[model samples]
Target: MAQDKIVFVYITFPNSEEAQKVGRILLEKRLCGCVNLFTNINSMYWWEGKIEVSQEAVLIVKTRESLYPEVEKEVLKNHSYSCPCIAKIEVSEVTPCFYRWLLQETGVEI
Candidate 1:
């Protein structure tokens, strides 16, 4: 994917409140154009050399690829987990109108 293309940053939070808090911060800072919150997600993963299971809320941050660092930094600063799940998934395609809107919302020149 192109460096300037948009991406979806997937982040897992302990609960909805924390997810919303961080999502709002990212929006207010214009680090991300939009955020979608998916709460009450069942997650199972390996941590500390053991399998762990928990209920978590997911925050999908829509932002440009170039702004990933800033988005990550802000998330790390506000996240409650010492090792939070922040993964960037590149968007292969997006509608032209939506792309322009996203860029505009994030304060990027279209």
Candidate 2:
């Protein structure tokens, strides 16, 4: 996003309710400024020596890199599963308005 800001956070939940729960927790604690939920996603992964594919709700979190650790911690704390999926990637593009709002809302230096 923006010139110097990064929105590197994504997490997947078993369902909409779990996604909503994690999203609200992050926002309430200011660990994240925005979290977009994608209700339909096909995830294929290997777990416990088995390949599994299933539909899941994905959470796209927008926040500074500085907040990543805290965001992950909070997600783990509120997540329903013992081990959750958290995929953090660097954002290469975002609208200026969205970036500004994100930075301003999170109280992060830009």
Best by TM-score: 1
Clashing pairs in 1: none
Model 2 agreement with the true structure over 1-110: per-residue lDDT tens digits: 53555766778888888899888888888877778899978899987999999889989998977788888899888888898879889988788888788888788675
Over the stretch 18-97, how does candidate 1's per-residue lDDT look in tens digits? 99999999999999889999999999998799999999999999999999999999999999999899999999999988
lDDT of residue 55 for candidate 2: 84
Against the true structure, what is every candidate's RMSD? 2.2, 3.1
Q: Give all TM-scores, in the order shown.
A: 0.90, 0.80
Evaluate residue 2 in candidate 1 and report its C-alpha lDDT on the 0 to 100 scale. Answer: 50
Question: Model 1 segments beyond 4 Å from truth?
Answer: 1-3, 46-50
Per-prediction tally of clashes: 0, 0
